[model samples]
Target: MKLYKTFTSIIAFLLLTSCSVFEKNRSEQNELAYMKNIEDVAIEVSKKQYVNLLQPGDRLIILVSAQDQDVVKVFNQNYSATEQFRESSVPRGNIISNSQPINGPTYIIDGDGFIDFPVLGKIEAAGMSLDHLKQYITSSLKRYIKEPYVQARITNYRITVLGEVRNPGQFTIADGTATVLNAIGMAGDLTIYGKRDDILIVRNVNGLISKERIDLTDAGFIDSPYYFLKQGDIIYVTPNKTQERLAKRDPNSALYISIASIVVTIIALIVRK
Candidate 1:
Protein backbone atom coordinates (compact mmCIF):
# COMPACT_ATOMS: atom_id res chain seq x y z
CA MET A 1 0.00 0.00 0.00
CA LYS A 2 2.89 2.37 0.73
CA LEU A 3 4.56 1.51 -2.61
CA TYR A 4 1.28 2.14 -4.44
CA LYS A 5 0.91 5.59 -2.85
CA THR A 6 4.52 6.48 -3.68
CA PHE A 7 4.01 5.52 -7.36
CA THR A 8 0.79 7.54 -7.55
CA SER A 9 2.46 10.62 -6.02
CA ILE A 10 5.36 10.42 -8.53
CA ILE A 11 2.91 10.08 -11.43
CA ALA A 12 0.91 13.07 -10.27
CA PHE A 13 4.04 15.21 -9.90
CA LEU A 14 5.22 14.23 -13.41
CA LEU A 15 1.82 15.04 -14.87
CA LEU A 16 1.77 18.49 -13.27
CA THR A 17 5.30 19.29 -14.51
CA SER A 18 4.50 18.18 -18.05
CA CYS A 19 1.29 20.22 -18.07
CA SER A 20 3.15 23.31 -16.81
CA VAL A 21 5.47 23.15 -19.81
CA PHE A 22 2.55 23.64 -22.21
CA GLU A 23 0.63 26.09 -20.01
CA LYS A 24 0.28 29.62 -21.45
CA ASN A 25 -0.88 32.78 -19.72
CA ARG A 26 -2.49 34.45 -22.74
CA SER A 27 -4.95 37.30 -22.39
CA GLU A 28 -8.70 36.58 -22.67
CA GLN A 29 -9.12 39.07 -25.51
CA ASN A 30 -9.10 37.84 -29.12
CA GLU A 31 -6.80 39.36 -31.76
CA LEU A 32 -8.61 41.67 -34.22
CA ALA A 33 -11.85 39.74 -33.80
CA TYR A 34 -14.31 42.42 -32.70
CA MET A 35 -16.49 42.76 -35.82
CA LYS A 36 -18.59 39.63 -35.55
CA ASN A 37 -22.41 38.97 -35.45
CA ILE A 38 -23.09 42.68 -35.91
CA GLU A 39 -25.22 44.03 -38.74
CA ASP A 40 -24.85 47.29 -40.74
CA VAL A 41 -22.02 48.64 -38.61
CA ALA A 42 -20.17 51.40 -40.42
CA ILE A 43 -17.45 53.75 -39.25
CA GLU A 44 -17.18 57.27 -40.56
CA VAL A 45 -14.04 57.40 -42.69
CA SER A 46 -11.62 60.15 -41.84
CA LYS A 47 -11.04 62.79 -44.50
CA LYS A 48 -7.60 63.66 -43.19
CA GLN A 49 -4.68 61.69 -44.56
CA TYR A 50 -1.32 61.77 -42.82
CA VAL A 51 1.21 63.91 -44.68
CA ASN A 52 4.93 64.14 -43.88
CA LEU A 53 6.08 67.71 -43.53
CA LEU A 54 9.59 68.87 -44.38
CA GLN A 55 12.02 69.19 -41.47
CA PRO A 56 15.66 70.01 -40.83
CA GLY A 57 18.19 67.33 -41.88
CA ASP A 58 15.76 66.01 -44.53
CA ARG A 59 17.22 64.99 -47.88
CA LEU A 60 15.14 65.77 -50.96
CA ILE A 61 15.21 64.97 -54.65
CA ILE A 62 13.78 67.88 -56.70
CA LEU A 63 13.59 67.45 -60.44
CA VAL A 64 12.34 70.08 -62.86
CA SER A 65 11.25 69.05 -66.30
CA ALA A 66 9.76 70.91 -69.26
CA GLN A 67 9.00 70.44 -72.95
CA ASP A 68 12.06 72.49 -73.87
CA GLN A 69 14.91 70.59 -72.14
CA ASP A 70 17.56 73.05 -73.34
CA VAL A 71 15.71 76.12 -72.04
CA VAL A 72 15.18 74.50 -68.60
CA LYS A 73 18.78 73.22 -68.38
CA VAL A 74 20.03 76.37 -66.58
CA PHE A 75 17.45 75.90 -63.77
CA ASN A 76 18.49 72.25 -63.25
CA GLN A 77 22.04 72.85 -62.01
CA ASN A 78 21.79 69.91 -59.58
CA TYR A 79 20.76 67.56 -62.36
CA SER A 80 23.47 65.11 -63.48
CA ALA A 81 23.46 66.71 -66.94
CA THR A 82 24.39 70.09 -65.42
CA GLU A 83 26.08 69.02 -62.12
CA GLN A 84 29.53 69.70 -63.59
CA PHE A 85 28.64 73.38 -64.08
CA ARG A 86 28.05 73.98 -60.35
CA GLU A 87 31.84 73.80 -59.65
CA SER A 88 32.80 75.87 -62.67
CA SER A 89 32.16 79.60 -62.90
CA VAL A 90 30.17 78.99 -66.09
CA PRO A 91 27.35 81.39 -66.78
CA ARG A 92 23.84 80.14 -65.93
CA GLY A 93 22.49 80.49 -69.51
CA ASN A 94 25.61 78.93 -71.11
CA ILE A 95 25.41 75.11 -71.04
CA ILE A 96 28.57 73.10 -70.37
CA SER A 97 29.81 70.98 -73.27
CA ASN A 98 30.25 67.16 -72.95
CA SER A 99 28.50 67.00 -69.51
CA GLN A 100 27.91 63.34 -68.67
CA PRO A 101 24.91 62.27 -66.55
CA ILE A 102 26.36 60.49 -63.55
CA ASN A 103 24.32 61.02 -60.37
CA GLY A 104 20.91 62.35 -59.29
CA PRO A 105 20.51 65.64 -57.44
CA THR A 106 19.96 65.84 -53.66
CA TYR A 107 18.97 68.93 -51.66
CA ILE A 108 19.57 68.84 -47.90
CA ILE A 109 17.51 71.12 -45.72
CA ASP A 110 19.67 73.24 -43.40
CA GLY A 111 19.12 73.69 -39.65
CA ASP A 112 17.14 76.87 -40.36
CA GLY A 113 14.74 74.89 -42.58
CA PHE A 114 15.86 76.35 -45.88
CA ILE A 115 17.31 75.01 -49.12
CA ASP A 116 19.26 77.13 -51.66
CA PHE A 117 17.92 76.47 -55.09
CA PRO A 118 19.97 76.97 -58.25
CA VAL A 119 18.29 80.28 -59.07
CA LEU A 120 15.47 80.75 -56.55
CA GLY A 121 18.03 81.33 -53.73
CA LYS A 122 16.99 80.35 -50.13
CA ILE A 123 13.40 79.15 -49.59
CA GLU A 124 11.62 78.05 -46.40
CA ALA A 125 10.78 74.33 -46.61
CA ALA A 126 10.21 73.11 -43.07
CA GLY A 127 6.61 72.88 -41.81
CA MET A 128 5.42 72.55 -45.39
CA SER A 129 4.05 69.36 -46.96
CA LEU A 130 5.64 67.91 -50.11
CA ASP A 131 2.71 69.05 -52.26
CA HIS A 132 2.85 72.58 -50.81
CA LEU A 133 6.56 72.81 -51.43
CA LYS A 134 6.08 71.60 -54.98
CA GLN A 135 3.43 74.28 -55.58
CA TYR A 136 5.69 77.00 -54.13
CA ILE A 137 8.54 75.96 -56.43
CA THR A 138 6.30 75.60 -59.47
CA SER A 139 4.80 79.04 -58.85
CA SER A 140 8.26 80.55 -58.57
CA LEU A 141 9.31 78.96 -61.88
CA LYS A 142 6.38 80.46 -63.80
CA ARG A 143 8.54 83.53 -64.58
CA TYR A 144 11.31 81.39 -66.12
CA ILE A 145 9.68 78.31 -67.78
CA LYS A 146 6.21 77.96 -69.23
CA GLU A 147 4.27 75.01 -67.70
CA PRO A 148 7.17 74.07 -65.40
CA TYR A 149 6.88 70.72 -63.65
CA VAL A 150 8.47 70.35 -60.21
CA GLN A 151 8.89 66.94 -58.59
CA ALA A 152 9.82 66.87 -54.90
CA ARG A 153 9.99 63.99 -52.42
CA ILE A 154 11.58 63.23 -49.06
CA THR A 155 14.30 60.64 -49.59
CA ASN A 156 14.95 59.65 -45.97
CA TYR A 157 11.45 58.73 -44.77
CA ARG A 158 11.92 55.88 -42.29
CA ILE A 159 10.37 54.15 -39.24
CA THR A 160 11.66 51.61 -36.72
CA VAL A 161 10.03 48.52 -35.14
CA LEU A 162 11.37 46.65 -32.14
CA GLY A 163 10.73 43.91 -29.49
CA GLU A 164 8.69 40.69 -29.65
CA VAL A 165 8.76 40.59 -33.45
CA ARG A 166 10.33 38.17 -35.91
CA ASN A 167 12.50 40.94 -37.39
CA PRO A 168 13.11 44.32 -35.74
CA GLY A 169 14.78 47.16 -37.63
CA GLN A 170 14.33 50.51 -39.33
CA PHE A 171 12.29 50.33 -42.53
CA THR A 172 12.37 52.98 -45.26
CA ILE A 173 8.96 54.03 -46.59
CA ALA A 174 9.15 54.47 -50.34
CA ASP A 175 5.65 55.92 -50.73
CA GLY A 176 6.23 58.50 -47.93
CA THR A 177 3.18 57.21 -46.01
CA ALA A 178 2.55 54.01 -44.00
CA THR A 179 0.17 52.75 -41.30
CA VAL A 180 1.11 51.15 -37.96
CA LEU A 181 -0.01 47.78 -39.28
CA ASN A 182 2.14 48.34 -42.38
CA ALA A 183 5.19 49.10 -40.24
CA ILE A 184 4.56 45.99 -38.12
CA GLY A 185 4.19 43.92 -41.27
CA MET A 186 7.48 45.31 -42.57
CA ALA A 187 9.18 44.05 -39.40
CA GLY A 188 7.79 40.53 -40.07
CA ASP A 189 4.82 40.86 -37.69
CA LEU A 190 4.67 40.38 -33.91
CA THR A 191 5.57 37.09 -32.23
CA ILE A 192 3.05 34.84 -30.48
CA TYR A 193 4.41 36.05 -27.13
CA GLY A 194 3.81 39.70 -27.99
CA LYS A 195 1.02 41.59 -26.25
CA ARG A 196 -1.62 42.24 -28.91
CA ASP A 197 -3.79 44.44 -26.70
CA ASP A 198 -1.08 47.02 -26.03
CA ILE A 199 1.17 48.31 -28.81
CA LEU A 200 3.43 51.26 -28.16
CA ILE A 201 4.42 53.93 -30.67
CA VAL A 202 6.82 56.83 -30.26
CA ARG A 203 6.39 59.68 -32.71
CA ASN A 204 8.16 62.96 -33.42
CA VAL A 205 6.36 65.73 -35.26
CA ASN A 206 7.86 69.22 -35.79
CA GLY A 207 10.30 68.69 -32.87
CA LEU A 208 7.60 67.58 -30.41
CA ILE A 209 7.92 63.96 -29.29
CA SER A 210 4.92 61.99 -28.07
CA LYS A 211 4.16 58.42 -27.05
CA GLU A 212 0.93 56.53 -27.74
CA ARG A 213 -0.33 53.09 -26.74
CA ILE A 214 -2.78 51.21 -28.98
CA ASP A 215 -4.68 47.98 -28.75
CA LEU A 216 -4.49 45.71 -31.77
CA THR A 217 -7.30 43.49 -30.50
CA ASP A 218 -9.78 46.38 -30.83
CA ALA A 219 -11.07 47.45 -34.25
CA GLY A 220 -11.46 51.05 -33.07
CA PHE A 221 -7.70 51.50 -33.29
CA ILE A 222 -8.16 51.81 -37.05
CA ASP A 223 -9.80 55.21 -36.56
CA SER A 224 -7.08 56.56 -34.30
CA PRO A 225 -4.75 59.30 -35.55
CA TYR A 226 -1.85 56.89 -35.20
CA TYR A 227 -3.41 54.46 -37.65
CA PHE A 228 -1.29 56.18 -40.29
CA LEU A 229 2.29 56.42 -39.07
CA LYS A 230 4.41 59.48 -39.84
CA GLN A 231 8.12 59.84 -40.55
CA GLY A 232 10.52 59.03 -37.65
CA ASP A 233 7.91 56.89 -35.87
CA ILE A 234 9.09 54.01 -33.67
CA ILE A 235 6.93 50.99 -32.92
CA TYR A 236 7.56 48.59 -30.02
CA VAL A 237 5.62 45.38 -29.41
CA THR A 238 5.50 44.59 -25.70
CA PRO A 239 6.07 41.01 -24.53
CA ASN A 240 3.31 39.19 -22.62
CA LYS A 241 3.67 37.94 -19.01
CA THR A 242 4.09 34.38 -20.20
CA GLN A 243 7.08 35.38 -22.26
CA GLU A 244 8.57 37.31 -19.35
CA ARG A 245 8.18 34.36 -16.99
CA LEU A 246 9.59 31.94 -19.54
CA ALA A 247 12.58 34.17 -20.17
CA LYS A 248 13.37 34.35 -16.46
CA ARG A 249 13.27 30.56 -15.87
CA ASP A 250 14.03 29.10 -19.34
CA PRO A 251 17.70 28.33 -18.64
CA ASN A 252 16.91 26.42 -15.42
CA SER A 253 13.94 24.49 -16.83
CA ALA A 254 16.10 21.92 -18.64
CA LEU A 255 18.15 21.34 -15.49
CA TYR A 256 15.02 20.86 -13.43
CA ILE A 257 13.56 18.42 -15.96
CA SER A 258 16.74 16.35 -16.07
CA ILE A 259 16.90 16.16 -12.27
CA ALA A 260 13.24 15.13 -12.09
CA SER A 261 13.74 12.41 -14.67
CA ILE A 262 16.71 10.98 -12.73
CA VAL A 263 14.76 11.02 -9.46
CA VAL A 264 11.80 9.25 -11.08
CA THR A 265 14.07 6.53 -12.54
CA ILE A 266 15.79 6.00 -9.18
CA ILE A 267 12.41 5.72 -7.44
CA ALA A 268 11.28 3.12 -10.00
CA LEU A 269 14.46 1.09 -9.46
CA ILE A 270 14.00 1.16 -5.69
CA VAL A 271 10.38 0.05 -6.02
CA ARG A 272 11.39 -2.87 -8.29
CA LYS A 273 14.00 -4.00 -5.77
Candidate 2:
Protein backbone atom coordinates (compact mmCIF):
# COMPACT_ATOMS: atom_id res chain seq x y z
CA MET A 1 0.00 0.00 0.00
CA LYS A 2 2.87 2.41 0.70
CA LEU A 3 4.44 1.55 -2.69
CA TYR A 4 1.09 2.10 -4.40
CA LYS A 5 0.68 5.53 -2.76
CA THR A 6 4.26 6.51 -3.79
CA PHE A 7 3.57 5.49 -7.43
CA THR A 8 0.29 7.48 -7.43
CA SER A 9 2.06 10.55 -6.06
CA ILE A 10 4.81 10.31 -8.74
CA ILE A 11 2.21 9.99 -11.52
CA ALA A 12 0.26 12.98 -10.17
CA PHE A 13 3.38 15.12 -9.94
CA LEU A 14 4.38 14.21 -13.49
CA LEU A 15 0.93 15.02 -14.80
CA LEU A 16 0.95 18.40 -13.07
CA THR A 17 4.35 19.32 -14.50
CA SER A 18 3.27 18.25 -18.01
CA CYS A 19 0.17 20.38 -17.69
CA SER A 20 2.27 23.39 -16.71
CA VAL A 21 4.46 22.94 -19.82
CA PHE A 22 1.38 22.86 -22.05
CA GLU A 23 0.05 26.00 -20.36
CA LYS A 24 3.16 27.85 -21.47
CA ASN A 25 2.54 26.85 -25.08
CA ARG A 26 -1.09 27.91 -24.96
CA SER A 27 -1.97 30.97 -27.11
CA GLU A 28 -3.19 34.31 -25.84
CA GLN A 29 -6.97 34.64 -25.61
CA ASN A 30 -7.24 38.42 -25.76
CA GLU A 31 -10.11 39.68 -27.88
CA LEU A 32 -9.41 41.61 -31.08
CA ALA A 33 -10.95 44.80 -29.71
CA TYR A 34 -9.57 45.06 -26.19
CA MET A 35 -11.42 48.31 -25.51
CA LYS A 36 -13.65 48.29 -22.41
CA ASN A 37 -17.32 49.25 -22.56
CA ILE A 38 -17.26 49.72 -26.30
CA GLU A 39 -20.46 51.10 -27.71
CA ASP A 40 -21.58 51.75 -31.24
CA VAL A 41 -20.30 55.21 -31.97
CA ALA A 42 -20.40 56.97 -35.32
CA ILE A 43 -16.79 57.74 -36.16
CA GLU A 44 -16.16 60.13 -39.02
CA VAL A 45 -13.59 58.95 -41.53
CA SER A 46 -10.46 61.05 -41.90
CA LYS A 47 -10.67 63.84 -44.42
CA LYS A 48 -7.16 63.03 -45.63
CA GLN A 49 -7.95 59.74 -47.31
CA TYR A 50 -5.26 57.59 -48.84
CA VAL A 51 -4.81 57.80 -52.61
CA ASN A 52 -2.41 55.55 -54.47
CA LEU A 53 -0.02 57.62 -56.56
CA LEU A 54 2.03 56.38 -59.48
CA GLN A 55 5.47 55.20 -58.44
CA PRO A 56 8.51 53.66 -60.05
CA GLY A 57 8.38 49.87 -60.68
CA ASP A 58 4.59 50.03 -61.04
CA ARG A 59 2.91 48.24 -63.94
CA LEU A 60 0.14 50.20 -65.67
CA ILE A 61 -2.40 49.21 -68.31
CA ILE A 62 -3.46 52.16 -70.44
CA LEU A 63 -6.08 51.66 -73.15
CA VAL A 64 -7.31 54.25 -75.65
CA SER A 65 -10.62 53.88 -77.47
CA ALA A 66 -13.03 56.05 -79.42
CA GLN A 67 -16.00 55.78 -81.79
CA ASP A 68 -13.67 54.56 -84.52
CA GLN A 69 -11.30 51.63 -83.87
CA ASP A 70 -9.26 52.52 -86.93
CA VAL A 71 -8.69 56.10 -85.77
CA VAL A 72 -7.46 54.98 -82.34
CA LYS A 73 -5.60 51.93 -83.67
CA VAL A 74 -2.29 53.83 -83.74
CA PHE A 75 -2.63 54.80 -80.10
CA ASN A 76 -3.23 51.13 -79.12
CA GLN A 77 -0.51 49.55 -81.28
CA ASN A 78 1.79 49.55 -78.24
CA TYR A 79 -0.56 47.09 -76.53
CA SER A 80 -0.15 44.58 -79.35
CA ALA A 81 3.61 45.14 -79.45
CA THR A 82 3.89 44.59 -75.71
CA GLU A 83 1.98 41.30 -75.98
CA GLN A 84 4.21 40.13 -78.82
CA PHE A 85 7.30 40.93 -76.79
CA ARG A 86 6.00 38.85 -73.86
CA GLU A 87 5.13 35.94 -76.17
CA SER A 88 8.59 35.97 -77.75
CA SER A 89 10.25 35.78 -74.34
CA VAL A 90 8.38 32.56 -73.47
CA PRO A 91 9.62 29.08 -74.39
CA ARG A 92 8.81 27.78 -77.87
CA GLY A 93 5.26 26.44 -77.55
CA ASN A 94 1.72 27.15 -78.77
CA ILE A 95 2.35 30.85 -79.25
CA ILE A 96 -0.67 33.13 -78.91
CA SER A 97 -1.33 35.47 -81.82
CA ASN A 98 -0.98 39.19 -81.14
CA SER A 99 -4.48 39.59 -82.62
CA GLN A 100 -5.88 37.44 -79.79
CA PRO A 101 -8.20 39.26 -77.41
CA ILE A 102 -6.20 40.30 -74.34
CA ASN A 103 -7.22 42.53 -71.43
CA GLY A 104 -4.61 45.20 -72.24
CA PRO A 105 -0.89 45.75 -72.48
CA THR A 106 1.18 46.31 -69.34
CA TYR A 107 3.49 49.33 -69.18
CA ILE A 108 6.32 48.96 -66.68
CA ILE A 109 7.44 52.17 -65.08
CA ASP A 110 11.19 52.62 -65.51
CA GLY A 111 13.57 53.28 -62.63
CA ASP A 112 13.28 56.98 -63.41
CA GLY A 113 9.48 56.80 -62.84
CA PHE A 114 8.70 57.07 -66.56
CA ILE A 115 7.03 54.74 -69.03
CA ASP A 116 8.32 54.98 -72.64
CA PHE A 117 4.94 55.39 -74.31
CA PRO A 118 4.81 54.90 -78.08
CA VAL A 119 3.64 58.31 -79.22
CA LEU A 120 3.38 60.13 -75.87
CA GLY A 121 7.16 59.73 -75.35
CA LYS A 122 8.64 60.07 -71.83
CA ILE A 123 5.79 61.67 -69.86
CA GLU A 124 6.15 62.11 -66.08
CA ALA A 125 3.77 59.56 -64.51
CA ALA A 126 5.55 59.10 -61.17
CA GLY A 127 3.28 61.08 -58.89
CA MET A 128 0.17 61.33 -61.11
CA SER A 129 -3.00 59.50 -60.07
CA LEU A 130 -4.73 57.13 -62.48
CA ASP A 131 -7.55 59.62 -63.25
CA HIS A 132 -5.06 62.47 -63.59
CA LEU A 133 -2.89 60.40 -65.93
CA LYS A 134 -5.89 59.50 -68.07
CA GLN A 135 -6.84 63.19 -68.40
CA TYR A 136 -3.28 64.10 -69.27
CA ILE A 137 -3.10 61.38 -71.92
CA THR A 138 -6.50 62.38 -73.33
CA SER A 139 -5.38 66.00 -73.72
CA SER A 140 -2.18 64.88 -75.45
CA LEU A 141 -4.12 62.58 -77.83
CA LYS A 142 -6.38 65.45 -78.81
CA ARG A 143 -3.59 66.75 -81.05
CA TYR A 144 -3.82 63.57 -83.20
CA ILE A 145 -7.26 62.01 -82.76
CA LYS A 146 -10.52 63.76 -81.92
CA GLU A 147 -12.76 62.52 -79.08
CA PRO A 148 -10.02 60.29 -77.65
CA TYR A 149 -10.97 58.29 -74.58
CA VAL A 150 -8.24 57.09 -72.19
CA GLN A 151 -8.49 54.46 -69.45
CA ALA A 152 -5.64 53.77 -67.08
CA ARG A 153 -5.21 51.26 -64.25
CA ILE A 154 -2.38 49.67 -62.30
CA THR A 155 -2.05 46.01 -63.36
CA ASN A 156 0.33 44.75 -60.66
CA TYR A 157 -1.20 46.04 -57.45
CA ARG A 158 -0.33 43.43 -54.86
CA ILE A 159 -0.27 43.17 -51.05
CA THR A 160 1.74 40.73 -48.97
CA VAL A 161 0.69 39.30 -45.59
CA LEU A 162 3.26 37.54 -43.46
CA GLY A 163 4.08 36.14 -39.98
CA GLU A 164 1.41 34.61 -37.73
CA VAL A 165 -1.50 34.60 -40.18
CA ARG A 166 -3.00 31.31 -41.28
CA ASN A 167 -2.10 32.00 -44.90
CA PRO A 168 0.94 34.18 -45.53
CA GLY A 169 1.67 35.16 -49.09
CA GLN A 170 1.37 37.88 -51.68
CA PHE A 171 -2.13 38.57 -52.97
CA THR A 172 -3.10 40.68 -55.96
CA ILE A 173 -5.71 43.42 -55.50
CA ALA A 174 -7.96 43.13 -58.54
CA ASP A 175 -9.89 46.38 -57.99
CA GLY A 176 -6.67 48.38 -57.42
CA THR A 177 -7.90 49.28 -53.94
CA ALA A 178 -8.17 47.34 -50.68
CA THR A 179 -8.21 47.99 -46.95
CA VAL A 180 -5.84 46.47 -44.39
CA LEU A 181 -8.70 44.34 -43.07
CA ASN A 182 -9.26 43.02 -46.57
CA ALA A 183 -5.64 41.92 -46.64
CA ILE A 184 -5.97 40.21 -43.25
CA GLY A 185 -9.11 38.46 -44.41
CA MET A 186 -7.36 37.28 -47.54
CA ALA A 187 -4.62 35.82 -45.34
CA GLY A 188 -7.26 33.75 -43.48
CA ASP A 189 -7.15 36.11 -40.49
CA LEU A 190 -4.53 36.13 -37.78
CA THR A 191 -3.70 32.98 -35.83
CA ILE A 192 -4.33 32.81 -32.10
CA TYR A 193 -0.58 33.23 -31.56
CA GLY A 194 -0.57 36.49 -33.53
CA LYS A 195 -0.10 39.77 -31.73
CA ARG A 196 -3.46 41.41 -32.38
CA ASP A 197 -2.48 44.59 -30.52
CA ASP A 198 0.65 45.18 -32.56
CA ILE A 199 0.88 44.81 -36.35
CA LEU A 200 3.45 46.13 -38.81
CA ILE A 201 2.75 47.66 -42.19
CA VAL A 202 5.47 48.50 -44.65
CA ARG A 203 4.57 50.87 -47.48
CA ASN A 204 6.31 52.58 -50.37
CA VAL A 205 4.88 55.95 -51.36
CA ASN A 206 6.32 58.08 -54.18
CA GLY A 207 9.82 56.69 -53.76
CA LEU A 208 9.74 56.91 -49.96
CA ILE A 209 9.59 53.73 -47.92
CA SER A 210 7.74 53.98 -44.62
CA LYS A 211 6.94 51.55 -41.80
CA GLU A 212 3.98 51.95 -39.46
CA ARG A 213 2.98 49.84 -36.48
CA ILE A 214 -0.78 49.61 -36.04
CA ASP A 215 -2.83 48.33 -33.15
CA LEU A 216 -5.74 46.12 -34.19
CA THR A 217 -7.17 46.17 -30.67
CA ASP A 218 -8.23 49.81 -31.10
CA ALA A 219 -10.96 51.01 -33.49
CA GLY A 220 -9.06 54.27 -34.05
CA PHE A 221 -6.85 52.66 -36.69
CA ILE A 222 -9.90 52.53 -38.95
CA ASP A 223 -9.49 56.25 -39.59
CA SER A 224 -5.72 56.16 -39.97
CA PRO A 225 -3.97 56.54 -43.33
CA TYR A 226 -2.70 52.94 -43.06
CA TYR A 227 -6.29 51.72 -43.12
CA PHE A 228 -6.23 51.85 -46.90
CA LEU A 229 -3.46 49.68 -48.20
CA LYS A 230 -1.27 50.93 -51.06
CA GLN A 231 0.32 49.02 -53.91
CA GLY A 232 3.12 46.67 -52.81
CA ASP A 233 2.15 47.06 -49.18
CA ILE A 234 3.37 44.38 -46.73
CA ILE A 235 1.40 43.52 -43.59
CA TYR A 236 3.18 41.47 -40.97
CA VAL A 237 1.24 40.04 -38.02
CA THR A 238 3.82 39.62 -35.33
CA PRO A 239 3.65 36.65 -32.97
CA ASN A 240 2.27 37.16 -29.45
CA LYS A 241 4.37 36.93 -26.28
CA THR A 242 3.38 33.32 -25.78
CA GLN A 243 4.56 32.39 -29.24
CA GLU A 244 7.79 34.31 -28.75
CA ARG A 245 8.45 32.47 -25.52
CA LEU A 246 7.86 29.15 -27.19
CA ALA A 247 10.27 30.11 -29.97
CA LYS A 248 12.98 31.01 -27.45
CA ARG A 249 12.58 27.76 -25.49
CA ASP A 250 15.51 25.37 -25.20
CA PRO A 251 16.20 23.26 -28.30
CA ASN A 252 16.91 20.16 -26.15
CA SER A 253 13.42 19.96 -24.69
CA ALA A 254 13.21 16.27 -25.65
CA LEU A 255 16.39 15.58 -23.70
CA TYR A 256 14.99 17.43 -20.72
CA ILE A 257 11.85 15.33 -20.88
CA SER A 258 13.95 12.14 -20.98
CA ILE A 259 15.97 13.29 -17.98
CA ALA A 260 12.79 14.02 -16.03
CA SER A 261 11.42 10.59 -16.85
CA ILE A 262 14.68 8.97 -15.65
CA VAL A 263 14.52 10.93 -12.39
CA VAL A 264 10.90 9.90 -11.84
CA THR A 265 11.73 6.26 -12.48
CA ILE A 266 14.64 6.40 -10.02
CA ILE A 267 12.38 7.92 -7.35
CA ALA A 268 9.78 5.20 -7.97
CA LEU A 269 12.49 2.47 -7.66
CA ILE A 270 13.69 3.94 -4.37
CA VAL A 271 10.13 4.14 -3.09
CA ARG A 272 9.53 0.49 -4.10
CA LYS A 273 12.68 -0.59 -2.19
Clashing residue pairs, backbone N/CA/C < 3 A, model 2:
none
TM per candidate:
0.69, 0.67
Give candidate 2's total backbone clashes.
0
Error of 1 at 52 (Å): 2.6
Model 2 worst lDDT window (10 residues): 87-96
Model 2 lDDT, full chain set: 0.71
Location of the lowest summed lDDT over 10 successive residues in candidate 1: 84-93
User: Considering every candidate listed, which one attains the maximal TM-score?
Assistant: 1
Q: Write model 1 residue lDDT over 1-273, tens digit each, in one string.
A: 588568767867876776666553324223433334223223422444577677888877777889998877777676654421121122122221133222346788999999998888998998888789989999999999999997765667778889888888887654466778777776777887788877899998768899999887666777788888887899999887767877988767857776886777678677767
lDDT tens digits, residues 47-120, model 2?
43556677788787777888888988777755644432221112122221233333455688888888877688
